[model samples]
Target: MEGMVVSTDAYASQVGLDVLQDGGNAVDAAIATGFALAVVNPEAGNLGGGGFMIVRNDEGGVFALDHREKAPLAATRDMFLDEEGNVTEASTVGHLSAGVPGTVAGLWEAYRRFGSLTWSRLLQPAIDLAAGFEVRERQVATLVAAQNGIRQFESG
Candidate 1:
Protein backbone atom coordinates (compact mmCIF):
# COMPACT_ATOMS: atom_id res chain seq x y z
CA MET A 1 0.00 0.00 0.00
CA GLU A 2 2.98 2.29 0.67
CA GLY A 3 6.21 2.70 -1.28
CA MET A 4 9.92 1.92 -0.99
CA VAL A 5 13.14 3.44 -2.27
CA VAL A 6 16.82 2.56 -2.33
CA SER A 7 20.09 4.08 -3.40
CA THR A 8 23.82 3.86 -2.70
CA ASP A 9 23.68 6.83 -0.36
CA ALA A 10 21.41 6.66 2.65
CA TYR A 11 20.44 10.32 2.53
CA ALA A 12 19.64 10.08 -1.14
CA SER A 13 17.60 6.96 -0.55
CA GLN A 14 15.71 8.74 2.22
CA VAL A 15 14.96 11.63 -0.08
CA GLY A 16 13.54 9.25 -2.66
CA LEU A 17 11.39 7.58 -0.05
CA ASP A 18 10.18 10.96 1.09
CA VAL A 19 9.17 11.78 -2.45
CA LEU A 20 7.21 8.56 -2.66
CA GLN A 21 5.52 9.32 0.64
CA ASP A 22 4.68 12.75 -0.69
CA GLY A 23 2.71 11.17 -3.57
CA GLY A 24 5.42 11.06 -6.18
CA ASN A 25 5.66 8.19 -8.63
CA ALA A 26 8.79 6.22 -9.27
CA VAL A 27 10.07 8.67 -11.89
CA ASP A 28 9.46 11.61 -9.60
CA ALA A 29 11.20 9.86 -6.72
CA ALA A 30 14.09 9.03 -8.99
CA ILE A 31 14.53 12.67 -9.96
CA ALA A 32 14.45 13.72 -6.34
CA THR A 33 16.96 11.01 -5.50
CA GLY A 34 19.29 12.22 -8.20
CA PHE A 35 19.13 15.83 -7.09
CA ALA A 36 19.66 14.78 -3.49
CA LEU A 37 22.71 12.82 -4.58
CA ALA A 38 24.13 15.96 -6.16
CA VAL A 39 24.11 17.51 -2.72
CA VAL A 40 24.95 14.48 -0.58
CA ASN A 41 27.07 12.42 -2.97
CA PRO A 42 28.65 14.89 -5.39
CA GLU A 43 31.50 12.57 -6.33
CA ALA A 44 29.12 10.40 -8.34
CA GLY A 45 25.98 12.51 -8.47
CA ASN A 46 27.43 14.46 -11.37
CA LEU A 47 24.67 16.88 -12.20
CA GLY A 48 26.75 17.95 -15.14
CA GLY A 49 27.20 14.40 -16.38
CA GLY A 50 24.77 11.91 -17.92
CA GLY A 51 23.75 8.27 -17.66
CA PHE A 52 21.13 5.73 -18.70
CA MET A 53 18.00 4.29 -17.14
CA ILE A 54 15.54 1.48 -17.79
CA VAL A 55 11.99 1.70 -16.55
CA ARG A 56 9.11 -0.74 -16.46
CA ASN A 57 5.59 0.47 -15.85
CA ASP A 58 2.96 -1.41 -13.82
CA GLU A 59 1.40 -2.37 -17.14
CA GLY A 60 4.32 -4.58 -18.17
CA GLY A 61 5.56 -1.95 -20.57
CA VAL A 62 9.28 -1.20 -20.48
CA PHE A 63 11.29 1.78 -21.61
CA ALA A 64 14.98 2.50 -21.99
CA LEU A 65 16.30 5.97 -21.62
CA ASP A 66 19.65 7.04 -22.98
CA HIS A 67 20.79 10.03 -21.08
CA ARG A 68 24.42 9.47 -21.92
CA GLU A 69 26.36 12.70 -22.28
CA LYS A 70 27.03 13.91 -25.77
CA ALA A 71 30.54 14.77 -26.76
CA PRO A 72 31.10 18.47 -27.13
CA LEU A 73 30.63 19.70 -30.66
CA ALA A 74 34.36 20.16 -31.07
CA ALA A 75 35.29 16.77 -29.76
CA THR A 76 36.82 14.12 -31.95
CA ARG A 77 37.23 10.42 -31.31
CA ASP A 78 40.99 10.73 -31.58
CA MET A 79 41.14 13.62 -29.13
CA PHE A 80 41.98 11.30 -26.27
CA LEU A 81 45.21 10.23 -27.91
CA ASP A 82 48.40 12.18 -28.48
CA GLU A 83 50.76 12.23 -31.45
CA GLU A 84 52.35 9.03 -30.16
CA GLY A 85 48.85 7.51 -30.06
CA ASN A 86 49.09 7.09 -26.34
CA VAL A 87 46.05 8.08 -24.30
CA THR A 88 46.69 11.60 -23.08
CA GLU A 89 45.95 12.47 -19.49
CA ALA A 90 44.36 15.69 -20.69
CA SER A 91 41.74 13.68 -22.47
CA THR A 92 40.16 12.61 -19.22
CA VAL A 93 40.55 15.66 -16.97
CA GLY A 94 39.30 19.24 -16.82
CA HIS A 95 36.73 21.12 -18.92
CA LEU A 96 37.84 19.70 -22.25
CA SER A 97 37.02 16.24 -21.00
CA ALA A 98 33.39 17.05 -20.34
CA GLY A 99 30.42 16.42 -22.57
CA VAL A 100 27.02 18.03 -22.74
CA PRO A 101 25.07 16.80 -19.74
CA GLY A 102 21.82 14.93 -20.33
CA THR A 103 20.74 13.89 -16.84
CA VAL A 104 18.33 16.74 -16.23
CA ALA A 105 16.74 16.36 -19.60
CA GLY A 106 16.39 12.64 -19.18
CA LEU A 107 14.86 13.00 -15.75
CA TRP A 108 12.41 15.53 -17.07
CA GLU A 109 11.42 13.19 -19.87
CA ALA A 110 10.75 10.37 -17.43
CA TYR A 111 8.73 12.60 -15.17
CA ARG A 112 6.74 13.88 -18.10
CA ARG A 113 5.83 10.39 -19.10
CA PHE A 114 5.29 8.64 -15.78
CA GLY A 115 5.35 10.99 -12.83
CA SER A 116 2.48 11.83 -10.48
CA LEU A 117 4.16 14.86 -8.90
CA THR A 118 5.19 18.30 -10.07
CA TRP A 119 8.77 18.77 -11.22
CA SER A 120 9.31 21.65 -8.84
CA ARG A 121 7.95 19.55 -6.02
CA LEU A 122 10.42 16.82 -6.77
CA LEU A 123 13.27 19.33 -6.77
CA GLN A 124 12.33 20.82 -3.39
CA PRO A 125 13.87 18.06 -1.27
CA ALA A 126 17.20 18.45 -2.96
CA ILE A 127 17.02 22.20 -2.60
CA ASP A 128 16.21 21.90 1.08
CA LEU A 129 19.00 19.40 1.60
CA ALA A 130 21.51 21.66 -0.11
CA ALA A 131 20.41 24.60 2.00
CA GLY A 132 20.88 22.89 5.34
CA PHE A 133 21.91 19.26 5.35
CA GLU A 134 24.75 18.95 7.83
CA VAL A 135 27.89 17.17 6.85
CA ARG A 136 28.11 13.70 8.38
CA GLU A 137 31.14 11.55 9.26
CA ARG A 138 30.72 9.42 6.16
CA GLN A 139 30.39 12.48 3.93
CA VAL A 140 33.51 13.95 5.47
CA ALA A 141 35.39 10.76 4.84
CA THR A 142 34.27 10.72 1.25
CA LEU A 143 35.33 14.32 0.78
CA VAL A 144 38.77 13.60 2.20
CA ALA A 145 39.23 10.63 -0.08
CA ALA A 146 38.08 12.65 -3.08
CA GLN A 147 40.46 15.47 -2.22
CA ASN A 148 43.40 13.11 -1.87
CA GLY A 149 42.64 11.50 -5.19
CA ILE A 150 42.19 14.81 -6.99
CA ARG A 151 45.40 16.18 -5.49
CA GLN A 152 47.32 13.43 -7.22
CA PHE A 153 46.19 14.86 -10.57
CA GLU A 154 47.30 18.38 -9.80
CA SER A 155 50.40 19.53 -11.67
CA GLY A 156 51.38 22.21 -9.20
Candidate 2:
Protein backbone atom coordinates (compact mmCIF):
# COMPACT_ATOMS: atom_id res chain seq x y z
CA MET A 1 0.00 0.00 0.00
CA GLU A 2 1.12 3.52 -0.70
CA GLY A 3 1.04 6.32 1.86
CA MET A 4 1.10 10.09 1.72
CA VAL A 5 1.90 12.65 4.39
CA VAL A 6 0.91 16.29 4.58
CA SER A 7 1.84 18.72 7.33
CA THR A 8 2.09 22.47 8.03
CA ASP A 9 5.79 22.40 7.27
CA ALA A 10 7.51 20.97 4.21
CA TYR A 11 10.41 19.65 6.27
CA ALA A 12 8.06 17.71 8.52
CA SER A 13 6.18 16.30 5.55
CA GLN A 14 9.47 15.20 4.00
CA VAL A 15 10.39 13.44 7.21
CA GLY A 16 7.15 11.50 7.09
CA LEU A 17 7.71 10.63 3.45
CA ASP A 18 11.20 9.43 4.22
CA VAL A 19 9.87 7.14 6.90
CA LEU A 20 7.25 5.74 4.58
CA GLN A 21 9.81 5.19 1.87
CA ASP A 22 12.05 3.42 4.34
CA GLY A 23 9.39 0.74 5.01
CA GLY A 24 7.70 2.38 7.97
CA ASN A 25 3.97 2.07 8.51
CA ALA A 26 1.54 4.96 8.78
CA VAL A 27 1.96 5.22 12.54
CA ASP A 28 5.73 5.45 12.20
CA ALA A 29 5.43 8.13 9.57
CA ALA A 30 3.07 10.09 11.77
CA ILE A 31 5.47 9.84 14.68
CA ALA A 32 8.38 11.06 12.57
CA THR A 33 6.33 13.91 11.15
CA GLY A 34 5.20 14.95 14.62
CA PHE A 35 8.74 15.05 15.96
CA ALA A 36 9.97 16.94 12.93
CA LEU A 37 7.22 19.48 13.43
CA ALA A 38 8.39 20.01 16.99
CA VAL A 39 11.66 21.30 15.56
CA VAL A 40 10.57 22.95 12.29
CA ASN A 41 7.19 24.32 13.26
CA PRO A 42 7.56 25.43 16.82
CA GLU A 43 4.72 27.96 16.59
CA ALA A 44 2.16 25.17 16.35
CA GLY A 45 3.95 21.93 17.15
CA ASN A 46 5.61 21.20 20.48
CA LEU A 47 6.61 18.23 22.61
CA GLY A 48 5.19 20.04 25.64
CA GLY A 49 1.64 19.75 24.27
CA GLY A 50 -0.77 16.83 23.89
CA GLY A 51 -2.79 15.53 20.95
CA PHE A 52 -5.13 12.81 19.70
CA MET A 53 -4.71 10.07 17.11
CA ILE A 54 -7.14 7.70 15.39
CA VAL A 55 -5.89 4.75 13.42
CA ARG A 56 -7.58 2.24 11.14
CA ASN A 57 -5.71 -0.83 10.13
CA ASP A 58 -6.01 -2.59 6.78
CA GLU A 59 -7.98 -5.32 8.54
CA GLY A 60 -10.63 -2.74 9.50
CA GLY A 61 -9.64 -2.43 13.14
CA VAL A 62 -10.08 1.06 14.55
CA PHE A 63 -8.34 2.57 17.55
CA ALA A 64 -8.49 5.91 19.28
CA LEU A 65 -5.67 7.40 21.29
CA ASP A 66 -6.13 10.31 23.66
CA HIS A 67 -2.93 11.92 24.83
CA ARG A 68 -4.29 15.08 26.32
CA GLU A 69 -2.38 16.86 29.06
CA LYS A 70 -3.49 16.20 32.60
CA ALA A 71 -3.83 18.86 35.24
CA PRO A 72 -1.65 18.57 38.30
CA LEU A 73 -3.18 16.78 41.27
CA ALA A 74 -3.12 19.95 43.33
CA ALA A 75 -4.86 22.05 40.70
CA THR A 76 -8.08 23.67 41.83
CA ARG A 77 -11.00 25.15 39.93
CA ASP A 78 -10.10 28.60 41.17
CA MET A 79 -6.38 28.17 40.93
CA PHE A 80 -6.07 31.10 38.56
CA LEU A 81 -8.06 33.49 40.66
CA ASP A 82 -6.49 36.49 42.32
CA GLU A 83 -6.89 37.65 45.95
CA GLU A 84 -10.10 39.46 44.96
CA GLY A 85 -11.39 36.32 43.17
CA ASN A 86 -10.86 37.92 39.78
CA VAL A 87 -9.43 35.88 36.97
CA THR A 88 -5.70 36.37 36.57
CA GLU A 89 -3.34 35.72 33.68
CA ALA A 90 -1.65 33.04 35.73
CA SER A 91 -3.68 30.31 34.07
CA THR A 92 -2.74 31.46 30.61
CA VAL A 93 0.98 32.02 31.19
CA GLY A 94 4.02 30.81 33.17
CA HIS A 95 5.22 27.49 34.57
CA LEU A 96 2.52 27.37 37.25
CA SER A 97 -0.15 26.89 34.57
CA ALA A 98 1.57 24.10 32.67
CA GLY A 99 0.04 20.64 32.50
CA VAL A 100 1.86 17.31 32.68
CA PRO A 101 3.17 16.80 29.15
CA GLY A 102 1.91 13.66 27.42
CA THR A 103 3.18 13.87 23.85
CA VAL A 104 6.12 11.49 24.23
CA ALA A 105 4.09 8.94 26.13
CA GLY A 106 1.29 9.12 23.62
CA LEU A 107 3.65 8.69 20.71
CA TRP A 108 5.32 5.77 22.42
CA GLU A 109 2.01 4.15 23.08
CA ALA A 110 0.99 4.49 19.47
CA TYR A 111 4.26 2.92 18.37
CA ARG A 112 3.84 0.05 20.80
CA ARG A 113 0.40 -0.67 19.40
CA PHE A 114 0.91 -0.19 15.66
CA GLY A 115 4.37 0.92 14.58
CA SER A 116 6.79 -1.24 12.59
CA LEU A 117 9.93 0.89 12.50
CA THR A 118 12.44 1.15 15.30
CA TRP A 119 11.80 4.13 17.60
CA SER A 120 15.31 5.43 17.12
CA ARG A 121 14.96 5.19 13.34
CA LEU A 122 11.76 7.19 13.39
CA LEU A 123 13.31 9.84 15.62
CA GLN A 124 16.52 10.27 13.63
CA PRO A 125 15.08 12.76 11.13
CA ALA A 126 13.89 15.03 13.89
CA ILE A 127 17.21 14.75 15.68
CA ASP A 128 19.06 15.75 12.52
CA LEU A 129 16.77 18.72 11.97
CA ALA A 130 17.26 19.89 15.53
CA ALA A 131 21.02 19.56 15.27
CA GLY A 132 21.02 22.03 12.38
CA PHE A 133 18.63 22.98 9.61
CA GLU A 134 18.31 25.99 7.41
CA VAL A 135 15.99 28.67 8.72
CA ARG A 136 13.83 29.98 5.93
CA GLU A 137 12.38 33.45 5.56
CA ARG A 138 8.97 32.44 6.93
CA GLN A 139 10.52 30.82 9.97
CA VAL A 140 12.65 33.88 10.63
CA ALA A 141 9.56 36.08 10.46
CA THR A 142 7.67 33.83 12.82
CA LEU A 143 10.54 33.81 15.30
CA VAL A 144 10.85 37.56 15.09
CA ALA A 145 7.16 38.05 15.70
CA ALA A 146 7.18 35.73 18.69
CA GLN A 147 10.37 37.04 20.27
CA ASN A 148 8.66 39.64 22.45
CA GLY A 149 6.10 37.19 23.77
CA ILE A 150 8.74 34.51 24.42
CA ARG A 151 11.06 37.04 26.07
CA GLN A 152 8.43 37.85 28.67
CA PHE A 153 9.17 34.58 30.47
CA GLU A 154 12.39 33.66 32.24
CA SER A 155 12.74 30.40 30.32
CA GLY A 156 13.01 32.32 27.04
Cα deviation of 31, candidate 2, in Å:
0.2
- What are the candidates' C-alpha RMSDs? 2.3, 1.8
Tell me the lDDT of candidate 2: 0.92
Q: Local error of candidate 2 at 113, Å?
A: 0.4
Where is the poorest 10-residue window by lDDT in model 2?
Answer: 147-156
Q: Per-residue CA lDDT of candidate 2, range 21-40, in tens?
A: 99999999999999999999
TM-score of each: 0.88, 0.92
TM-score of 2: 0.92
Per-residue lDDT tens digits for candidate 1, residues 1-156, read 277888778889998998888777788888899989988888788688887878899999999999988988888889889888999877677668878999889888888888888888988888898888778888798888789657876886
After superposition, which runs of candidate 2 have C-alpha atoms over 4 Å from their true positions? none
Model 1 residue 116 CA deviation in Å: 1.0
lDDT of each: 0.84, 0.92
